[model samples]
Target: MAKSNKPIVWGLFAAGGTVCAFVIPVMILITGVLLPLGLFGPPEASYESMTRIVSNPVVKIVLFGILFLALWHAAHRLRITVHDFGIRNDQLVARAVYGFAGLFSLIALVTLLSF
Candidate 1:
């Protein structure tokens, strides 16, 4: 008998899903809810509001974390969908898809932060 790492993989996935689901909705809420409500100081504070919210070091870190996790999650689910549809040579396809997903996600993150 041998101890295996399968459970660890599954646990990591569960954690990722749980955290993304929770954090993503909150991110949406803050952007969607408070922005409309003008609760982030004032209605005139449009760019000011965004700069205030995103300028915090902690918020930048968290946004980057969420963006990467979201891309990884999307890539994984899309890979499975391709596999489940009986696409031929799915493992090879999954690898290519994920590699591009990661590369593009990094590019997008960099582009976003430059603004």
Candidate 2:
């Protein structure tokens, strides 16, 4: 029998896809549509509330998870898309896409923690 890492990648892909499909859109709506429209509160109040949201450790972790999963999901999608576009070098493509994902994920974690 042979072991492969496909299961792990596929697991993250599935979970990330679910997160991207569901949570990310709502995030866009809240941050994009509602925030600018003053639906959350007065502008100053919203800014203070948002600052408070990031200062809390729990929210930071949640944001990290959302960002990390989204980045992973997009990287996987881009890898597949590049292959579909006739890029025959799988190893190189895999490393590039996943490398960028990892780098950005680390950046996201650091940025979140800084708050």
Best-matching candidate per lDDT: 2
- Report the CA-based lDDT of candidate 2 relative to the real structure: 0.90
**13-96 in candidate 1: lDDT tens per residue?**
566677788888887888789777877767666878686777776777777777767766666667677878888787698688
For residues 1-115, write the lDDT of model 2, one tens digit per residue: 6999888888888889998898988899999999999997998899899999899999998888988888888888899999899998988999999999999999988888888
Each model's backbone clash number: 0, 0
Pick out the ten consecutive residues of candidate 1 with the lowest summed lDDT.
Answer: 6-15
TM-score, prediction 2: 0.83
Which residue segments of model 1 deviate by more than 4 Å?
1-12, 29-44, 108-115
Best by TM-score: 2
Count of backbone collisions in candidate 1: 0
